[model samples]
Target: MSSSPQTGSEPVTAPSTTSLTLAIIVSCELMLMLDGTITNVALPMIGDGLGFTPAGLSWVTNAFLLAFGGLLLLGGRAGDILGRRRVFLVGIGLFTAASLLAGLAQTPWQLVVARAAQGAGAALAGPSTLALLTTSFTGEHRTKALGVYSSVTASAMTLGLILGGVITTLASWRWVLLINVPIGVLVLLLAPRHVAESPRHGGRFDLAGALTSAIGVVAVVYALVRTADHGWADPTTLVTLVAGAALLAGFVLVERRAAQPIMPLRLLAERTRAVGFAIMLLVPMVTMSFQFLVIQFLQLVLDLSPLQAGLAFLPMAAGLLVTSRTANGLLGRFGTKPTAAAGLLLLTAAAAWSATISTATTYLGGILGPMLLIGLALGLVIVPINVAIMSTVDPQDAGAASGVLQTTMMTGAALGIAVLSAIYAATVGSTSAVLVGDDAVALGMRHGFVASTVIAALALAVTLAGYAVRERQSSHTK
Candidate 1:
């Protein structure tokens, strides 16, 4: 295995310009993250305006996710080979053009296609955001930058919901997508001036590995999305799932043989980094599932309007922003292992607490406390885990590493939604006769939260166990 990269140990940019550089990177990251959930609150409005059928409406969101998740690895590697700043501008430009297309789209298919294009652009840009941050800042500055980045990563979805509601209510649903035009144009204009380009690593691009990985991820994500509509036993689902797995296996083989692999296996060879990747995968599973279930609970059971439900997440957003800002201090004082464990512990507890909700439960009674705790837990967990994975990577491979991290996150989100949605569906289907009305839905949501609790607990176990083993090995060597 190759040794960890030490490039991040020192700053790449001049100290005077680091803050401006950070703002640019963070703004881009926020834009990407916000898009992940911003359209959700506006989906009904979009469907109505576009005359979408029930099943077809979902494609508006799924198309974006499928493309984004599929191309992230390729995007990251492209940044490494071609130059990050250049690729980032290309991505932002494409995304801006696609956003305009989406806002102007007359048909459902056109909108879906435009959304997919936007996702492709995001895939190109997403990895470089973190790659640039890791390369540009060092020491306490890196930690602080990561803290701000993590805060955006964790809270952006909730903020997106809020923003979507406000935009859709105050203006039209088109504005939700159209709003990106100005932001993207501004970013495109300023990025070249403020963002320093990374040194391009000279290598033969791993074409074979890239094709297999991208196709494999898209196939898998499509299969998972299908599971919400078709059962796991459906022939199409099984075929796609198997095909995706085979393609991914082929990608591994190709990567291993390639002279300059798109994703170096060496990155995962280190125990800490591998564990960090696993935890990142698992934590997102819980968070995405939690969000999905809670949104349903607020809208279906509590009968809140979209705007009200979006505003209800204010406390969680506030908590995330506050705690994420402070997480760097916690990490400095307690170190990555303990801080991560504590965060996971809190996440597990919050998921469990959320699982106790019923039809009778009020927002203040069961949801508020857990939402706040979830915010705090995510801030603590995401920042340290990001530090663990990115801080140790070789600078040359930072783009690839960032891509893998994001791809893992996307896969986890898809897996979580698929798994929890299946469970909830099964619960509701079986209990439909026994329970009446909102009670059945509440029970299903509770079951989904229960599953999320288990997922969080497993992540906690892995984190603690991984650290314990490392400590034991250290003592033995001593």
Candidate 2:
């Protein structure tokens, strides 16, 4: 196992060809990332249109999340054994068709099923984009390409809220899903010509590993989702949590024995890669919780319309795009550890600042600064961590690596929202005394931000500790 990350078995493509390929890959990623948050703004519209009970409405989001998060490992490995380009096309095509089905769905169940199909498609296609990008470029070109990818990734969720608000306001909520159709169609048609296929590894599919891991992930994510509605002590939550843990333990056993494991356990063996993955998990925990709580603050306390609330996130998106363009240079100059630490520091400050907001706090006075800081932090943080994790990955395990990285992120998001929402619920309590005004909601939201602050601080501590360990090892070698 060589540590050097070579531009895999892909042939050297022309610059024009590379640019087109990147465009296609980025387009696919944007669509997937957008879908993750786009429907959030339209949730009310969807619930009303489809006659969903308050409890049932959550499934629209959770269905897609469960499917995507659960199948990501299998999807990534499928690309390794099958073919990245073929898998990419098939995944995007399925996602596009599922989007259409969701848009046209007349019933709640129909839409939920379609959303799940979309997640399955995303799981298949998402890993290949990064795997392909890493394989297609090397040296400075790779860094710049990754910068672009990171920017798109970091900004897409915020952009999704903005676009969701726009589409839902002017047209209808259905357009939120339907919007992916043309983009997917374009990517599917152009991908084969531009996106070069990776050389597939020779191995039998790890069916047992796949089943255990996928089921385990789904069970865990379902448990997390349920925690938002039912407390952690609920019977369903406790049962699923234990079951998911057992299945995942079984998955580890299966992978260790399998000739061709879907998730190569060896990826987690390297300390740097492991640390990078941990940071990746923790960073999303803060971001997702921040977004979830802040959106509620914007609407419930501030009386902003959906469109206005979405527009408020523009500064964060702008900061992300600007900082991402420069993060490559920062990585080149300061190296990975310092750059990541700085980002996490910024994240801590932003979360701490956001924790001080009240019902009287205006958006410009309180929200804008933290939003901008958070955006910049994410760009700086995500790029370095990505580079650190993927830069030395063996091309043979690229898909699995990509899959694991994404799974960690999705799991982090799900876990963060559940935990923070639980904190909010606990603070608010069942008493009607606290329900008298928006002040209680504001206080609960403040507590959520405080928790986010603690999560960010913990991530920073871990990053610094990892840096110190690496430095000590380097001195010993000398």
By lDDT, the best candidate is: 2
TM-score to native of every candidate shown: 0.88, 0.89
Question: In model 1, what is the error at residue 371, expressed in angstroms?
Answer: 1.1
Please give the CA lDDT of all the candidate structures: 0.78, 0.79
Report how far off residue 65 is in candidate 1 (Å). 2.8
Off by over 4 Å in 1: 1-16, 47-59, 106-108, 424-440, 469-478
Clashing pairs in 2: none
* Per-residue C-alpha lDDT of model 1 across residues 140-192, encoded as one tens digit per residue: 67767776887888888679878877887788779889999999999987887
lDDT for position 405 in model 2: 90
Distance from true position, residue 179, model 1, in Å?
1.1
lDDT (Cα) of model 2: 0.79
